[model samples]
Target: MESSRNLKMKFDDLFDVLVKDLTENQPADTSPALKWFQQVLLYNVPHGKKNRGLTVVQSYEFLIGEKKEMSDEDFKITAVVGWCIELLQAFFLVSDDVMDHSITRRGRPCWYTVPGVGLIAMNDALYIESSVYKLLKKYIRNKPYYIDIVDLFHETIHQTIVGQCLDLLTSKEVNLDGFTLDRYNAIVKYKTAYYSFHLPVACAIYMVGINDERSHQLAKDILLKMGEYFQVQDDYLDCFGDPELTGKLGTDIEDNKCSWLIVQAWSKADNRQKEILKVNYGKPEECNLKMVKMVYEELNLRTVYEDYEAKSFQEISKLIEGIDSCLPKTMFNEFAKKIYKRNK
Candidate 1:
């Protein structure tokens, strides 16, 4: 991959162009509503690792190949679609923090938790979601695949919401009986996978004018597996990762999330171990956290996670090798490599 320094410089340039389009280019620049809108974009978007947005551009590069360069306008359009992915992510996070009652995000207070924002953050979140279409309409309205691209965004947002619903319900009462691998798979596939992995590649696929169902299906199957594996890594990091690096505090345990760690640990625990978990698993106390973590250690859950990681990587690699399509193997390989051992 190119240096993140180079990627950020490119993304930042496009971000300025987008800001102007939303503000000074269209409306009265001095309007208070425009000012608040600008603040929303400045604070919530572009702050994270930019992985999903980057994936859109990189995947398109792989599809377009070195011999056939797109027009400069086409290049900017793909990059802006990538930015749209980031905007959608911001929308999810701003609202998710409110729903999850989260404190910190990206190393600072969540939008909802920021003083003076409160419930107004909900409207801001909607604005962020709506902005994705606002962007697509302006930049890509004339493309043949414009309708397809719009439908893709609408479907992805819907799938992610469904996944979020499953997550909230699963953790509602913290009864360990409901924390199954099947349940975890569903949550990750919709909540994290569809948007993070599937949507970006699919967006690029449509951009390149490949509208056939067979190609899309093949890509989705492979990418969904990658998404599940990525979330597994995320679950591992939430507990063990540095808060300074992760830029968010881990609350999976306290929040009764059907996290990969807790579910795997539960399945491996003895009756006595199970009883210990039942007593302390979802409690918010420090002692409770230690007690649950101790069980994970005794079970060697970290080792279990490492083994799963290696196996998942191999499985995905093989799936890519066996694919039969115009979609480049290098694109899938690049994506697999990016998420395989990521720290943040």
Candidate 2:
């Protein structure tokens, strides 16, 4: 608990550093843009749980445990990279809310929804992405793995954009036939897994001098599996989660997202249930929403998700055990434990 608290404190302090460096140090002539960008970062960057960013720090610590304790400078460098991950996360969310026409996020109006923001949020997202490299160049360029980190971030961003494109195309048509597990897997793997799960740990690996294909492939394989599991949990939370607890209203149903819940519901539903879903699945009206929820409850998707969650947890645990390298199995375990039965 103490370690977690200290990490949280460090993570918050890093946000202050990022905000100051990016927003306060610019030329006075650039102050308008810089100040606007500051509000963008203030609203979007550091609000969430910070799990992905902190994973970089935690994974680095785990990988280097046998070597030596991290110096304060080492910790700051890792946290800077971690905050870059958070910036990337913010970029995605801010832009996604705009694309999805979402209103709320993290228990508040999304950056795009805030007064005077609207579509300007897209430019803010661009600023966030550009700042990622600036911060990286300033903080991490001296490291041997500098180029690798840059390439990894660019690659993951492209993958996420492609996933978002596929998601938009897929969701454009609300046919129940479109929401398959295969498409769902593709969407989540590209959209959420690469950046959220693999990239941070990959950064840690490169930093720790574990850059071999064998080790990275192993880490990517396990992490993507866990990432898939995590997204399924997210899909479950979207439909069933409390807005007060989850900090945002779910729009998957209204948006016709290729979510795991809809896919499972479609697969298990009978003809009558399918008809009800066909009538109600994609509409934003409350009556339609209630009908969709009724179908889900009647099918008992909550129970189905509970079973799948338990099974996936067991499967991922075994996958962690099957690791055959010098890579730390406990690091994978730590990642797994964070997501295994999480509520939010």
Q: TM per model?
A: 0.96, 0.98
Cα deviation at 166, candidate 2, in Å, is 1.5
C-alpha RMSD (angstroms) for model 1:
1.6
Candidate 1 lDDT over residue span 1-344, tens digit each: 44667766787689978977776655565588778888888999978888888778777778888877666676688889999999999999999999989999999899887778899999999989989998999999999988998999999999999999999999885579789999999999999999999999999999988888989999999999999999999999999888988999999988888899988988999998899899998889999999999999999998999999999999999999988988889889988998888887
- Candidate 1, clashing residue pairs? none
* Residue 222 lDDT in candidate 2: 94
How big is the positional error of residue 342 in model 2, measured in Å on the Cα after superposition? Answer: 1.1
Considering summed lDDT, which 10 consecutive residues are worst modelled in model 2? Answer: 1-10
Computed on alpha carbons, the lDDT of every model, listed in order, comes to 0.90, 0.90
Model 2 per-residue lDDT tens digits across residues 1-344: 22988988987887887899998867889988987988888889989999999999998899888659888887898899999999999999999999998989999998887889888999999999999999999998888999999999999999999999988998887578988889989999999999999999999999989878999999999999999999999989998888888898999998877888889889999999999999988889999989989988999998999999999999899989999988999999988988877877
Off by over 4 Å in 1: 1-4, 25-30
